[model samples]
Target: MKRILVLLFLVLCYTNPSVAQLKKVTLEEIWSSNFSPERLESIRSMNNGNQYTLLKSNPNNLFSAIEKYDYTSLQRIETIVSTEDNSDIPYFTTYLFSEEESAIILGTQVEKVYRRSTKGIYYTYDLANKQLKQISDQKIQEPSFSPDGTKIAYVYRNNLYVFDRITSNRTQLTFDGLENNIINGIADWVYEEEFYLVRAFEWNSDGTKLAFLKFDESEVPVFSMDRYGEDLYPSQTVFKYPKAGETNAKVSLQIYDLVTENMDLVSLDSPYYIPRLEWRNNPDDLSIHSINRHQNHLKLWSYNVLTKKLSLLHEETDKAYLKIKDDLTFLPDDRFIWSSEKDGYNHLYLYSKEGELLNQITSGAWEVTKYYGYNPETSVLFFQSTENGSINRDVYSITLKGKKKKRLSSKSGTNSADFSSNFSFFINTYSSANTPPIATLNSADNGEEINVILDNALLRTKLLSYEISPKEFSTLSVNGNDLNMWMIKPKNFDPKKKYPLLMVQYSGPGSQRVANKWNNDNDYWFQMLASNDYIVACIDGRGTGFKGRDFKKVTYKELGKYEVEDQIKAAEELSKLAYIDEQRTGIWGWSYGGFMSTNCLLKGNETFEMAIAVAPVTSWRFYDTVYTERFMQTPQENPSGYDENSPLNYPELLKGKYLLVHGSGDDNVHVQNSMRMVEALVQANKAFDWAIYPDKDHGIYGGNTKLHLYTKMTNFIMKNL
Candidate 1:
């Protein structure tokens, strides 16, 4: 009788949901596409509002084709273009339609030049004639169609060129472009890295004039990295890199006339940085955003090309610094929609064509995260906001007067939408911590569901067979602030048993790690760690975003001080929990988070027992001007802020196991950071482990790179923590 009762208890435990036998997640499966959720790739809404186009891959892995689908029926209508069927074109990965949808420009053989920049072989396909013509004989960058689709403009070898479709004539617009010296119609390394401007050119409404930025990097200092390949001698790849307080590339704005073949340089009031430029509804009115070296004061100017007049439209000043974004959009009548943090939160505002303040479109304590386009016919503007909650995003629509606002997205979590051009319908994607992404077509007017496009039901069902722990969301008081946090423990967690804690964070300014969203790739790794009897957690401290502007900018000028303090305090507070083992605390991060982790392990020497930093910036002095200066000013001006927060300054504080990793070819945060930190630790007689990946960029990823790196990291954690 005793043996039968024991067998019954064992059987009950095996069948129970809390202690069921489930498959453990592996690092190989985490890095591969095995757990990747199905997504609607490259969704572009058609002008008709009832149809949309997306890229569909062939089951045989031959090529991908662009197919049009009806929103109402959720059925594919027809294939627009196919690389497999048309042997004339190579396998194209990207497609873009002209303004009138008459022609499509296809990009093939695309290769990355840097972050947010790519060079590829491009072709122009005429829909009416079924003719495909290569735009250039060599790879080009940023090929864009003119308004009439008669000509295509692109950058090749740093020079600007225009290809006429009718006559097949390629015209060289600028001839002064040279490698690392003069860049025409494209942003240089610093601008591309910091300002997120790759194609530094724009075509006017009429397509007769082209406005482009010229980056003269002759005076900027050069940075080189040795590329070790299958050769006897390694080659050096050199390019201009402006460290903090260093000389930057002298940038100028110029306009080229297609009819007269004349290039005119626009005169301004000694602008320091021309971050953004866009043409309004009128061809003559071009709007430009310029900021001073401090990046605290920004001015929006309207330049009339025909009259050669420049006038200030609006100006914004912030005590900390302003973030330049692509949110300035002009309406049909030329009144623009802009987002700013002037009211202690990021919100939308409407401005007249002449730069007069019309009215604040949306206002509250929360933030308007995304500014979708405005529909003139219905006079309703669509956007995504955090009004529901800071961690939750919901789609919303409001009129010009901010009245009759309606929440478009039904489900909670991180909900985003891709609206049709006519604003008649939208494809809403919804996801939460436990749910995979589900996409549905909905009516733009009333937020009623029209059809379910792709729900990822299969992935959701498959996840049930895995021992994935649910994230426990809560707020923890640390350093006199309620910081957002989430934790993942073992599936069969016991209140009496203590577990080793591993805290993860990316505590950069205006960044968030803890949010109500579906699991990312890192979350899967955390789940794997939890399966190994480790408790994984993340905390968005003071400097993290979505709370408000004041909370985010509190760490300005001192990049790592408050952020590191919050992380340390949070860890210390979490150690008081009954389920947390205080002696076995560890922390790890990447990039800015790496900087934070390194500091926490040193400053919180008694707290964190181990740390892992990947591609970390050891000092602000080694970073770029635009980003670093925006936060901490110049290293020359704020010497104490830069030096004191840098982990390189105090290697003697090391009392824990540290693992430092970096890519030798890291152009953004160079390998010099890790090397300097390694030297500092060695001189201090502190034991540590480090790895340098040769010829890999900041991401440190390639064929087997990420897998091997993660495996090494896991082994280190198992051995140390």
Candidate 2:
């Protein structure tokens, strides 16, 4: 009887669905697209509000096509163009419709230059005549149609040119453009990296005048990196990069007249950073937004073409520093919508075009996260905010007076709304930490569901085959603030057993890691770590965003001081948990988080036992001006602030297992950061491991790149922790 009972118990254990039936997730499958969620590809809403276009590939993968679908029925209405049919161009990837929808331009043979810049072969398709024409034989950047759809303007080899789509004639607008000294109609390296402006030109409403930025980088210093590819030796990629307190490129605003062939420069008071340049509704009035080097004083100057005079429209000042964003919108009458943090929260306000204060549109303790476009026909403004919760986002609509506000998204997770061209309908993408993305069409008026677009049910069913654990969300009161946090415990967690802990964060200013969103690629890797019996936790400590302006700007002028303190203390406090193994605590982060993780392992050596830093900034002096100067002023102005928080100044405190990884081709956060840290630790006789990915960018993602990185990290964790 005893032998029979033992055999039955063994058979029952093998048949258990929760333990034996689920498969373990592998690093290869996690980094691969095997478990990726289904999504809409290149969606373009038509002006009719009832139809939208989609770029889809056939099953054979030999041809690609653009097709239109009805919004209500979710059925294909017509095929716009196809490579398999009579379409002349081969497999276009991107499309741009003219203002009147009379023509479309497709981009093929595309190549990326940076994070936000690209070069491509462009072709224009006439919808009425069904003619396909190439704009340029060579690759160009930022090919845009004029307001009237008669001409196309693009940048090539640091110069600006205009192509007449009808006559097929090209006109070079600027002739002084050179390789690195003079950049016409395009942002230089520093401006592109920090200010987020690439195509440094804009066409007016009438399309007769073109306003563009000219960057003269003759005095700025250049940085170079050795690119080791499949070559005999190696090549070097060098570009102008202005570090902190260094001389920046001389930028000027110029306007070119197409009719008279006259070009002239505009004189403005914004000498430090010209972040934004926009044209008003009158076709002649142009707005120039500027801020000082400290970024505390910002002014919006308006210039009138007829009067030829510049006037200040508005100005914003803050105790810490002001943030420049793409939120300036002008109504038909020239009254504009502006968002500011003057009231301790980012709220919207209406301002007359003549610099008069009108009224505040929205007001509350919470911040308006997104400012959607306004519909003049219904007088309703759509936006997204944190009124529901800080970690959650919801869609909302309000009138000009901030009345009759309605929440369009009902789910409690992250809800991002993409409106149709006419604002008659919007597609709301809802996701939570425990749920996949579900997209549905919502009516703009009463927030009613019109149709279900994609639910991602297949991804959810596929995820059930693996051992998964839902992330536990909570709050940690550290340093007199209720910091938001989340933790992923082992699937079969037991309180009596102690498990190693690994914490991840990206504790940059105005950044958040603990949010209610679906899993990213990192989350899948975290789940794989959790399956290996490690408790993964993430915290949004002080200096993180979404709470209010005060909470975010507290670390200003001292970028890594309070942030590192919070992380160290938070780890110390979390070690007191019953299920946490205090002896084997580890932390890791990328970029800004890497900076913090390095400091935590040094300053909090009593608490954290290991750390991994990827592409970290070792010192503020090596960072750019627009971003680093905005937070910490200048190294000359605040030397102590820069030197005190930088990890390069103090490496003798290291006493734990440390892994530093970087990419040689990281133009944003240069590889010098990790190299300096490595030298410092090496001189201190601290034992550590470091790696460099050859010819990889800051994201460090490519074929077999992420898989190899995560596998190395997993092996390190298993060996050390």
Candidate 3:
């Protein structure tokens, strides 16, 4: 009987669900099962506001189909089109429905041009006839359906052209556009990155005129980089890039009249930067947001297309620099809703058509993180804020008159809502550090949940198999400030034993790292490091977002000075802990954080023993004029600030093991920054390692690229620290 019981116990041990030996979660499994597999994406509400379409991908394959759902029942009644039904045309990344919903523009084979720019082959899918036809033989940008839905306007090769689907003909709108000389319909690199605009041309309400910003980049300096390929010879990509203190492209506002085929250039009072231009509700009226050279003052002007007269609407001035937000919405009544930081926090404001300040829509110490949408019918404004905690976010709705604020999401996790067209309903995507993503359909008025789309049950079940540690959230006082921080200890952590510390941060202005949200690939890597007997930590310093204007703007005029100091001080305090190995500390970051990491290794050599910076901006002089000048005021004026804070100037201080990685094709934070730093370190006789990914962008993700990167980073951390 004892031998029989022993055999049964052995079988139970091998087959027990709870006590069975579990396998460690790999990167692929974590990423694949991270989100609900059946969640919808690119959900859009039709103009009628009764129905919506969700782009759902096949579970077996990623090929997508458009499924139209009733807003009331939340039931998908029919599939409009699927890639399997038509194999001649490739799957689409996104679909844009016309105003009448008679035609849909499908975007496919998208190749990213820059941060906000892409080239995609477009096809017009007729909903009534169930027919598909390619719009152009070549890829284009900003393809928009005309007001009548019979024509489409797109930009190709820097020129604007209008195509008539019914007539099967194309008409060129502008003949002056030339590559590397003049750009008519699309924004340049600096404007797209800094101002958050790419489609430089706008369609009038009547579709009779197109207002566009023409950029003459003749005076701008050409920045060149070598693009090494498998071919025998390497090629050079040169483009007009306005660096800090360099000459910017001369911009002018022009209007193209379809009726007269005449273009008129409007001259403003000041030779300032035209950051944004849009047509108002009234077809003839256009709004232009212009900023001065110093970027301290911004003026919003309304121009009459027919009369060619410009009137100043609103002017915003700051002692530092004014931020350009995405919440610029104009109502049918001509009153506009805009966001500003004039009250020391980003708040919504209502302005009349003629620039009369109506009222302050939102006011508080907490800034609105995202302006979802405004419902004029209900007079409610939906937005997301960090009202619960600095690291947490929740959706909220307030009356347009700045009264009766109500929290839409009841959960204590990170909640974000995508409102329907009429604001009657919203799709809530909620998650926390411990919880995976949960998507649901909710009523926007009373925050009543209707249907639960995805609960990520499989992911939770899979996570139960692995031995993992919870991310410990805390606050640390560094450089006279209490900074938010999170730490992940090893599964087998011992208080008596010293472990090497690994610090990660993304110290960009108006960016947050310590958030109450699900982990991404980077977090998994950090966990992997923790599993390998290292302590991982992340700190949101003064320059990070969500706290307030004072906390974020403290680093202005001296971009890297206070940020680097706070990080160094945090490391110094962290190293004092008895369980931390002070001599074996390392730091790594990407982009802005990369800039911070490189500076930390150079400035805080005594604290950090190893550092890795990916696509870092070693010098502000090598960055764009708009972003650089906004923070540090142009290198000509703030030469001392630019030079003293740059990592290139302190090469002799790089005494630790350094590894710099960059993508050869990175348009943003060009590879020049890393190459220059590498040259400086080489001249200083500093021993370091670097990997330049061929034809990769700033994000550096591709086929087997991310795995290779993680392996390389893992090897670096193991060998160095």
Candidate 4:
């Protein structure tokens, strides 16, 4: 009887009262603010890029202003700063300006100190005589402004200071800063968690030279933890973490000389890793870049500072490792502009200002995903790529001799943009997988559409009172390659019913999460696991990224070997579908997708039967050392590539049902990688379910703690899949 008329049409489509009156999205309306969305915050563009400014707030006067606008009629036009006319410091949260925008800084009460450091209560203001001042009563770090906006610098206990906007005094500048031993101008915690470095100083293209980076860390090696707050005992949080084959932190490269107050130190034929210093438009040139502790050679030097000489301008190497960005760009005849993948994909080149190779402005085989500058009076160039595919992203423009290209985003999904300092407008933003981001403003010469800045059409009419299935993206072909997936299911879905699959992934390396834009917060927690009945997917396997560089360095030195063999061969080919079920499989992830869902629940123990792993690392000789030796190069040079993709070196290849979350002050995947994978699954006796979450870090939310950790992983996926 056709399976009892398809189980009575899936029980009359769940007793259809208009599908039981729609409304299913709730985890307190996906963590409240009643579905927020209407953005365009913090903008910028002025310096005659024909005006722009933004910030905005006013919800019937709880005040917040900044305003300005008008990059070719995107409207508004004045107000520049507020909290109902700023009566001094009780209102600032952020601001910066001064490259002759005549001063601004502002900040106030900021806080956060790890993960892009902070700590604030600054304030300079003076948009021509409105004065303000403040800059110190302590709390600081990366304050800025000095491009003749007349001095401000900043950083406080780990040294570096300055202020003076007309002598409000405060010049300290480094007396061998101390803390966990001499840090100087910021960036210490393993160069701010592995070279995403946080203000280890800069200031030159005419604020009279500054450059920085000191960090001696008294021969590195510290690492402690235990914070457990509401203090009745627990206290630790130590520092200097080097990890993988340890000891780092000698790091030198200094500079400072605002009219010879002197500081010097630059001697590098291998500073081992400065990872970018920058100054370029010739104010006595700077550039820097460096790398190597086997980050496979990267150089780029140049130095100079009034002839203290250094010059080796370009060198790159890479038998698998050289990636770095913020693309360089000098060209006012200093001819720089970089971006490389050495002809295997990442494109754009043109070199010169003393480094040689002159042109290769953009090539094919996709990838660029954002470079966007160098109009040099329309010799064109601009970027953002994946030439319209690898999970979309468009906006192009080529031709610094790579000959005419074009595509300024006529969206087919994620667009991006933001221009205006003379690209004559841009803004863009866009979105897709059934759009809900819009943004607009356009016309970078031909991409038309001039206006609408943020049309998340009332968040697509409040997602039509809820129930949305959408997603579906596709690609698949499991282990032999073609990955990029995405799924969703359940809202009235059926192809003869079975469902329950799960699978999410991260497969890190060049990282991509089957992108196409919109809906994050884990896409509304994978649309609440597809409205509670399961399905959800996501793949982007084999070391993930826009298909290239030999599909992302073929998992280089084998970190989680071929991303855990392409997510256990893409969950055994999505459990040979027929509406999936395959014994209701499951998998989940968090840090490096919780080390690829604890190495696919112990090497895909027969294709996963449950897993969660929130902060997981479970050892790469306990991580950090420039992202685990840029793809596993040192545990004394790959101890069988870190104990064969560590899940705490195979806890007797545990078979299924696991949970293990973490946080106990994580500071980046350290809850000792889930208490050493719960002591190798209690010496391999197995049986799981774990969690920690006290003093949380590595994003273990703060309040209702990510809704009580997703309602305890939605009651352990309705009691273990």
**Model 1 CA deviation exceeding 4 Å by range:** 1-19, 58-61
Lowest-sum lDDT 10-residue window in model 4: 56-65
Cα lDDT tens digits, model 3, 1-721, are 9999999988887676456664554556544435333345667887766678988665457487888988778788788888887776477878888888898899887887878899899999888887787889998998988787888889999998988878779899888888778898899888999988899888888888888888899889998878887889999888889998999989999888888989888888784689887889888999998899888898889999778898999999988888777788898798989888888888899998888999999888788889998888878889998888888889999988999999999888799888778888888999887787898889998899998877888877766666566788999999888999999998778999999999999898878889888867677777778888899999999888888888998888898999899899999999999999999999999999899999999899999999999999999989999998988898888889999999999899988999899998898899989989989989999899999999888989778777787788889999999
How does model 3 fare in lDDT?
0.86
Q: Candidate 2 at 661: error in angstroms?
A: 0.5
> How displaced is residue 360 in candidate 4, in Å?
53
Q: Please write out the lDDT profile of model 4 over residues 515-629, one tens digit for every residue.
A: 8888666677777778877898888887677777878888888878888888888888888889898888888888988888888888888878888878878888888888888
lDDT digits (tens) for residues 533-645 of candidate 2: 99999999888898999999999999889998888888888899998989999999999989989999998888889999999999999999888998998999999999998
CA lDDT, every model vs. true structure: 0.91, 0.89, 0.86, 0.82
Which order, best to worst by TM-score? Answer: 1, 2, 3, 4
Model 1 over residues 1-721: C-alpha lDDT tens digits?
9999999989877676456678889999989968899876768999888888998666466587889988889789998989777888678888999989889999888999999999999999999988999999899999999998899999999999999999999999999999999999999998999899999999999999999999999999999999998899999999999999999999999999998998999988888899998998898889999999889999999999888999998999999999998889898988888899999999988999888888998999999899888999988899999998888899999997788899999887999999998999998999988788888889999999988888998987777778899988899998889998999999878989999999999999998888788867888889899999999999999988988899999999999999999989999999999999999999999999899999999999999999999999999999999999999999889999999999999999999999999999999999999999999999999999999999999999999899999998999999999
Error of 2 at 252 (Å): 0.7
> Between 1 and 3, whose lDDT is larger?
1
* Predicted structure 2: lDDT: 0.89
Best by lDDT: 1
Superior candidate under lDDT, 1 versus 4: 1
Poorest stretch of ten by lDDT in candidate 3 = 30-39
Clashing pairs for model 4 are: 370-384, 590-594, 591-594
